[model samples]
Target: MIQKKAYRFLLFLILQSCTQAQTFNKAKLDSFFVALNKNDQSMGNIAISANGVLVYQNAIGFSQINKGAKTPATIDTKYRVGSITKMFTAVMIFQLIDEGKLSFETPLARYFPQLPNASKINIREMLDHRSGLHNFTSDSLYSTYMGSLSLKLK
Candidate 1:
């Protein structure tokens, strides 16, 4: 088993090293974002990275609008994200379980013992939204605490 794991790791490293460096067209990206901002078509940040190197980053549109006042978005702007976080959490948890680092039957208490009835909540239940967890995000102050962010890399 150990030898097989090592062999796979070596193969992965070899393949990674064999890949060629990628180039991006920064002018095209800038033009596209400029068009989007000019036409009021989209608002958000975009970042492109290749081989662990940041190649391009740009932001467009307003971050907030209140009382007819607008705040322009920047590359570091924060946005509110609601239930979409559940999708990322689910995918990461599934990956851990698939890699044998976690199990569906693992109790939430293993990591969050302070949570209400955590011992009774399992990974599967949490992923399925059946854990009976409280939805604190519905509170009015949730947005005031921390805003959400979106990121994509290619």
Candidate 2:
């Protein structure tokens, strides 16, 4: 799932960067997203901005997917962002590096000494996903915990 989201984000970035002009065909983009939602390929809100101004916004499908009751998704509906957090973390890391407050070569122990092999792992390794750290989401217990939390939150 993370890999799929990463690929989608990378493709979006490539497309965004390749465009020389800021202009976009809003109708075509809207149709594309509508088709994706109709085919059950996508279920989320999307917002596009240019020069810090909102350009377009749309939402499709349901916020909750359970069989019992589902909440229709809206522009204001919130969803679990998941691995998108990694991208923000990477950006922050880069910003810190630029500010000379952090370095890629710094050991993970400096921030997270409790993690296994933190002394041997570096920030760069973590950023590149080569740190040998266990993915908590891959554990069955994590899903169980999240499920319980959601139930309680409701």
Candidate 3:
């Protein structure tokens, strides 16, 4: 009799846990993010998933603020990642190097032979910012180029 009662209690506890996990308080989550947005604490999208299924998704704040005009951020917003790309590139390059698929001494020409002096540029030089490559984004025509339909390099 005691064994049967214990088994029933265990089953009840398992069911209760599953119900609580599946029926998450979405309103509470939204309110928390809304408070953050109102307080200017965060300005980006967040997505949560469970068992390969998305559970919660939200976006907050402005994507762009130019001359006091704001563009409300959305889940589809594309933010310029900027220097963060350098970090990701470095990490991936290091991984490849560690796996023996690449080396710091690899010449850039192997991948970008069209670039000027690519044969002289090594992975180490590029990673160390000593490759002598021109900063295209710093040029006067950069904005115009960005506004153009084709962003491809000549």
Q: TM-score, each model?
A: 0.63, 0.58, 0.77
Among all candidates shown, the one with the greatest lDDT = 2
lDDT head-to-head 1 vs 3, winner:
3
Q: Quantify all predictions' global Cα lDDT against the true fold.
A: 0.75, 0.80, 0.79
Candidate 3 global TM-score: 0.77
The total of clashing pairs for model 2 equals 0
Q: What is the Cα-based TM-score of model 2?
A: 0.58
Deviation in angstroms for 108 in model 3?
A: 0.8
Model 3 ranges with Cα > 4 A deviation: 1-20, 148-154
Tell me the tens digit of each residue's lDDT in model 1 across 1-154. Answer: 6654564475355335434434455675577567667866678887766769776788899988889998888998877675899999989998999999999999999999999999999999988889999876788876655443233210
lDDT, residue 126, model 1: 89
Better of 1 and 3 by TM-score: 3
For residue 2, give model 2's deviation from the true position in Å: 24
What's the C-alpha lDDT at position 92 in model 1?
A: 97
Q: Which stretches of candidate 1 lie over 4 Å from their true place?
A: 1-27, 49-55, 140-154
